[model samples]
Target: MTAEKEPHLSVARTATSPSAVQVVDLFCGVGGLTRGLEDSGINVVAGLDSDADCEYAYSVNNDARFVHANLLETSSDEIESMWSAGAVRVLVGCAPCQPYSKYSRGTSKEDPSAPVLRFAKYVDDLRPAVVSMENVPAVSRHPAFNGFLETLASAGYHISWETLPASGFGVPQTRKRLVLMASRLAPIALPASNVAKAKTVRQAIGRLVPISAGEANKVDPTHRASALSAVNLERIRNSRPGGTWRDWPDDLRAACHKGESGATFPAVYGRMEWDVPAPTVTTQFFGYGNGRFGHPVQDRAISLREGALLQTFPQDYKFEKAETLRSFALVGRHIGNAVPVALAKQIGNAINSHLEKYI
Candidate 1:
């Protein structure tokens, strides 16, 4: 999957030039949202993230400055330093969602600090002209999340929010995320679903240059899966596409599969269907036993490039240099956690419509 080069624009003296507005990405893991916004003519000036892995990808890929600091600890004065005078500011945040995700249901809410609450504090302090947040749909229902929205409302922002399916916006994955946009200028809405027919797994990765287990593609090395342990290989071979451990032979079942509690969660240790969009790609997509992460047609797990493509990233999106396998993991996590690029582009287009009215 080759990346189509971005169109270069020459300097021009105009009121509506790309440089007129500056976007600050918060919790900007690998700059997925920033890339989409930049593609839509937004000037992405700075990206803030605590993860060291984000530095190279955000800086090199987006050509934006990367600030390595905890978002919860950063002060408004610190944020202001990243902006130029007289530039329209846009605040984009996708706070860490693990605490509020369905995966964390067993965790207690009384846990000392919450990152989402801290993120709202930054919004209150900065009060940028535009604010956009994306997270799991469950976050919208959380009391902490509701309070964040109220804070924005009290600050005079007209807000609109919804839980959107990524497939609706042309991502070839069945991922649903919550998106919010607020502005003092006027009301804002998310972009309407563009893909009636969801993109299938085959459409997304079937044409990729094939590679054997543990072998990277010759043209694009990133499109490669990790080597599987002998036990894991046998486990995957026993799993059927769209089927789970229940479909496995009794002799091959894991010890957990023999228990009653494990019987209830059947989506794990499964393969994806070639005709349908993939199940949500997670950070552990390179592991066959992680969720329904096995490739639809291939015998191994989906490769790094396949995971990015499923997340709506262009084929040639740069990952960290080879020495940093950990950076690759971080990049994969950020990509998996991102609001699909296709969806972000639609959100950008919606904001553009509002901008047109003001301009």
Candidate 2:
């Protein structure tokens, strides 16, 4: 779809003032990173993304200009124009990571280096004071990633990187991602995880108004649940929380499961446990067959809002307008792809703390 630009807020422009720590988020999908930075009291001047679908969410949720431009096409001059000349500049880039995701290992052979290379090019061109990027854990092992680090180090940036579990950062999901931070100002480090006891699935969505399979909560469209077939519902009814499809009776088992290869993939057709953090939320989290997305007690897969909440998005974070379609596939992808707001907030706080040392 052709990307449409969202309306601009005057306050978003004010962030470019000389005194604020101005940030320009690259590939800023739906403003999850921007919102987290804002929560940490940073001044984000703008966000840029090629996806037209992200415009409304980014603009509505954070005080940042949403530029509907692809990173590959946007020039250093164009990005520089968005910030003041004297402000402490930071660039946040979390490139799309499917190429490096664990699930993509065997089936997908895509290289997926374009976005990473584009981000590195932007850093080389802009030479922002601070740079932050997050991706799948596998990215840390890639040769290109090592090359990117070398480039940053050559530019005199004190870099720190680590792979952290989202549960450790208070996200009610077990997602793990590689995070890297580099700063020319001084040595900077990633924030230590805060979730002493990881938040549980029940804690994240216990109070939302319940919805049955295929039912939409009239009060909140995002709370709509995906429908289940009669047989699927019966399977879920028999399945135990945290148990795999192996819990199913022989009659309800998939034909594939009865086959020789079925034992290899056991996470599917499972229900989330109430007391533990959920499995990593994926692009198809609304489907029961996708990961362990079924609700602890509810007879349906978790709702769209539930999925968002699990990703640590604020309860009121806006994704689309009330009149929007709120399609399961679209919303599901948006929620799943987002970097957890809480984890991003920790990154922001770490950067802010590091900056404080120099300021």
Candidate 3:
């Protein structure tokens, strides 16, 4: 049966035989998870998301067909239609996680669990052979997660989860993520952490051509940093690796830093250490004042390309075409908000190994 109510997709994933497992990724922003899973030889067939702007990057970077639609509007029947007749099904997603992030704790006005609840419905309707999900560490604690557990239990799926750091999976940042896997085929588990092999800032972006504040690198598009004011330039000039605004001259300090609360958020206006993994990359990572985003020795903030590299994206990964107008705010959101490609690949590796056991 053809998809009538399904969100129209321009391209379809290559049809696979029933012996092969296919994946449909939900909330595929710029195709990070999809790309990583495909790299693991998992044959991700399609990805769906609400943002149409993601279409260009998502389609350009990955083989999966992009479906521009919200998960809330999607039905399980429509999802099942993407696969060949009687194909082994897998559902994977890293839902909108801002509401469950530690930074937005107690401040999320939206129902943070809406996506989780939606995901549960799809699992029940489709009853795929395997399921996978990743999100901020806090998601494991939310009430919605409990509801998700109940749904899986009712469906007779075995589950495993852990709050693992991104560095543990070779990402060049210390981002803690909650990864969960469930399967009706057999008990499954995420791969073991590899923290001892963690990549560092120097290892991730040390070889890229250096560009000053406001200057775009001639060789690469994402290698552009936001322009720094004269004051902020001097602020970074005086900043040391791992040092905060406290290292700046008192004359250059913001008013908020003079109060007793000065001790709070000491990481703000800080520079990253070259020898260590970066602090968690955030939505505002391109701005010098946003967390520890300043380059260790440079008198500028880390550039868009640097942030993406720190997130374990390939150096040539096309976020936007080089000719397009790439703003720091716009591109930064895509890089920082994505699942670090390295971490996603680790999850994919686990899924592949699990599938092989039953294959």
Candidate 4:
């Protein structure tokens, strides 16, 4: 089915009921999380992020005020003011998870800047009616992560958390993320996976307005890729669906592939499969050497548009203007990292059902 026909898909913000609960999105890179929340009838009053590139897209797409401030630096008073202005204060945070990701396997925690732990401080201070956090699955096992849950418990929240597979909720990718929900109203469970069969790359991107190398889609310009060099062009052509660099001829393989470290990173320099859900779309999705980012049938790495679409972004979602490459990257990264709209909506639906008693 075309993305347009997908019932769960929504992009641009719509007018919500005045009774709609207001949300404050923390670390709201480009508002992907807010978009999902807004679609579920939440009014996103504001979005906060450190990256300036996120400002335009977050503001324009979701029509929420964008605050370019580091979560660590922003004072509790500032957060409280923002929350008080909203109808029903919902604090959502997606702290940086790279330091705790399984991908950073050999890295030591002794590294000076560990920001994930700081999220607990924000939770302690704001004390919103509800708190939701999403992050890499590996983080759930961390001591700091456990401590954060403890902090929430101390604040009188009945919490529910689980590691969820994105594909289980109809996302066209195989990614696992930890989702946590805390509330005083009662114990809140996240939505169950809605998908019975996994969606594939073909199902996600096959019908989008197509564009050539270095060309932008006229209808929605952000759906384009930077042009490929001659060598890279040939490399992508030889890469088969779901196949890695091992399929390449000796002459075509990068020198790194012949080395020991390279052998361990087989998923890099790979192509996506048409029949299976894509590998987790990451910030570097526009780069062919990053994960299985290449199109299964097309001879180009997935475009920014395809990446966003695979993440269930609405076709009409406004990214940064055409000239802002950095903004596009920020928007793409946020969309890639976002909880799938379908998944978020399911969570909202679950919350709605749970709230029926009070309503």
- Indicate which candidate wins on lDDT: 3
Give the clash count for model 4: 0
lDDT of candidate 2 over 1-359, digit per residue (tens) = 11444454222244435556888898888877888888888888888888878887787777777888867777888888887767888999788787778754245454577788778888888889899998889988777788788889888889999999989988988889899999988889898988789999989999898789999877777888899999999989988899988988889999989888987878788899999899898878899987788998889898889999998899887777778756788888788888889998999999899888876
lDDT tens digits by residue: candidate 4, 73-113: 77767776664333456788687776776544346655323
Candidate 4: lDDT of 142?
78
Order candidates by TM-score, high to low. Answer: 3, 2, 1, 4
Put the candidates in lDDT order, highest first. 3, 2, 1, 4
Residue pairs of candidate 2 with colliding backbone atoms: 3-52
- What's the residue-level lDDT of 130 in candidate 1? 83
Q: Model 4: runs farther than 4 Å from truth?
A: 1-20, 84-86, 103-114, 323-332
| Winner by TM-score | 3
Each candidate structure's TM-score, on Cα atoms with residue i matched to residue i, is 0.89, 0.94, 0.94, 0.87
lDDT value for model 1: 0.76
lDDT of 4: 0.73
User: Could you tell me the lDDT of residue 50 within candidate 1?
Assistant: 83
lDDT of 3 by residue, 1-359 (tens): 11122346533444556577888999888877887887777788888998877777777777777799878977777888887666788999988888877655247666788999999999999899999998988888899999998999899999998888888888988888888999998899887886677789999989998899999888887799899999999889989999888888899999989898977988988999998999999989999987899998888999998998998888878878778966777788777778888888888899988888986
